[model samples]
Target chain A: MIILIHGLMLIIIGIWAMLTRKNLIRIIIGFAIVDTGINLVLVAIGYIKGKTAPIINDAVSTAQGAAAGMQAVDKVVDPVPSALVLTAIVIGLAVTALMLAYAIRMHKTGRSLNIDDFEEQKW
Target chain B: MIETILTIVLAIISLMAAVYAVLTKKTLNAIIASGIISLLASIMFLLVSAPDVAMTEAAIGSGLTTVVFLYALKHIKDRRSTHDD
Candidate 1:
């Protein structure tokens, strides 16, 4: 239920951002929003029911009496999404930086940031 | 149960901010609106038990990104007319 709402909202925002926003910067921001929404959805998907952290430690082993400790620790939320989100974050940063750099360069060359202003490449 | 409600509320806020970001005529306003959307989304991430994602969203989504956008905005003059040929 929670995942559905978050996922749906993410899709809607991504679509809206892609549709509107004339300025290149706004469009880029929209992309970022879409990126964030997707990340949230991914994290939500990995959440488990009443799970503990995936760490296996001496304290937990002693508390759970060693027999059920292994099973208990194994019930932790899936770490895949967490790993993926970390990668996604780095990628997002790289892309944002590249896009901003491009925006800067475009502004320098054409003296404008409006999407419609750059027609020089059309020909 | 409560988590679902919170998610719905955050989703609504994010969508509203997204709409405002898209609808605003001024570029700077649009950027700020987008920032709000990111900020809300970060909080939503926290509620969902994604502290790592929440931190990233809070830092990159709202912090560095906004600063970069504003810096870029500062370098360029505002072109009021979108239809200028």
Candidate 2:
């Protein structure tokens, strides 16, 4: 679908930013964008057209409470991807925090935010 | 019909914000733009019928992430100013 394509485009843009940006914080921002793009792609791929979300609410479950489980099977989109995306979001936040911490340390030692300033790691 | 239009609009805005965040010169502007990207993405998630993901993205991606970035920026700026003085 269009959202899938959009997610791919976002991923490409994020990678471009990550590779081209000179600032450490900007690179981390690029990483966050990439994370969002991946989450979008996963959720989009799991989406079933014309289906509602995977929730067994009154809409999905009719008067027959016993058959509600069966009814929801066909009515809802895949829930696994949504669940995966949730976990991915948390992981992305942790990664971003760790990267920012590293950035802070790097700035502290080097006294510069530019990527070009630190020549110690360059090969 | 309306849903399709909404999706398209959201997608366009999200893309433009992402580009601005990446290309913007000001770190603060880039940070805010990225937050906008996250907010728009949460909206798209709602359009796609993933409310849980949408909620999580709105809370963590747009809210917590922005706060973290701003705090980090403030920390860096404060350190720089102190070092100067």
Candidate 3:
């Protein structure tokens, strides 16, 4: 429960940085922070108190090999959210890379990293 | 009990680092602070019993992301120096 709130706080801080920072790189850092926050929230949501991971290891069952799969479901936390977070992490990396590439190209063309200097792209 | 304490500490530190990252004037310092946030977050994931996410966050989030940002900064610096010449 606390972790969920912490994640939301982080997301807010990241958004604040993104909105206020003038440097393009600073904004990218903010985006990365937001990515981390979202991942944390997803994992926190799947976590059940007093439950182990969804992996069916020896802890879930020892002697009952045949019924282990059936028993493991109730013993572990949800796996779907973990899987979703894994995908999100990968996608976040790709997006960060793409953003950084754009920043580099923009700096090359505009000759500045300051957001305000890119007036030609603004409305 | 220990896990709870650890979680609280990690959360506080990561929050402080995030604030410092945004408020700091140096881009390099901000990058390092963001890396700190990622590293601490991976630890937080471990506390939540998500070891796989923890490992991935530590490796890609803290490791690769920081390296990429540093490289990008270097590239920008190099270009500026050359352009000035």
Candidate 4:
């Protein structure tokens, strides 16, 4: 419950940052915040009370894990979210790098990082 | 009780950093603050029982991303300085 609220708060703050900031770097920062927030929310959703890590270790079960089988599943937390988050984290890094590269190019072409200066098409 | 306290403290740290990163006037400060936010988030991931995710967040989200941003910033500054000279 508390985890959900915290995750949601982070998401809202990140969105606000993205919506209000004009600097390209700041916008990228906001995008990272939002990315982290979503990852947090996903992990929070996967939490189950009193369960251990989703590993087949001896600490989780007494019957050597593989032999424990059904008993192991009941004691461990869900592995799905952790697996998914691994991929998400790497993708987030790639996206952030791409965005920063774009910002560098924008600065090169426009001589500014304010983002508002990039508007070549006028109303 | 202790877990709850830890979670609350971490959440406050992360959200504060996020807000500061957004609202700060200096671009560099904003970038650093955002990095701090990611650092705290990795800690939170550990508390939530996702050590693998925490490791990824710490390395890629907090560490690699900040370095990349710094490199870009340095590149821009150098180009601008050369142009001025």
Candidate 4's docking class is medium
Quote the lDDT for B2 in model 3: 84
TM-scores for the candidates: 0.81, 0.96, 0.97, 0.94
Question: lDDT of model 2 at residue A9?
Answer: 90
- The alpha-carbon lDDT assigned to residue B14 of candidate 2 equals 91
Which has the greatest DockQ?
A: 3
Docking class of 3: high
lDDT of 3 by residue, A1-123 (tens): 878888999999999999999999999999999999999999999999989988788998765766998889888888888888987888898899899999999999989999999887788
Q: Which order, best to worst by TM-score?
A: 3, 2, 4, 1
Model 2 misplacement above 4 A: A63-66
What is the Å distance of residue B35 in model 4 from its true position?
1.5
lDDT of 4 by residue, A1-123 (tens): 576788888888888988988888888888888898889999988888778778776786678545788788788778899999999999998999999999899888888888678777556
Write one digit per residue (lDDT tens) for candidate 4, span B1-85: 8989988888888778888888889878877887888888888888778889989999988799889888888888888798746
lDDT of 2 by residue, B1-85 (tens): 8888888888899999999988899999989988988998898888788999999999999999998999899989999999956
Give model 1's TM-score versus the native structure.
Answer: 0.81
* Candidate 2 or 1, higher TM-score: 2
- lDDT tens digits, residue span A1-123, model 2: 778888999999999999999999999999999999999999999988889989889888874666888888989998999999988998899889999999999899999899999998899
Off by over 4 Å in 4: A121-123
Instruction: List ranges where model 3 is wrong by over 4 Å.
Output: A63-66
**What TM-score describes the B chain of model 2?**
0.94
Each prediction's Cα lDDT score?
0.73, 0.91, 0.92, 0.84
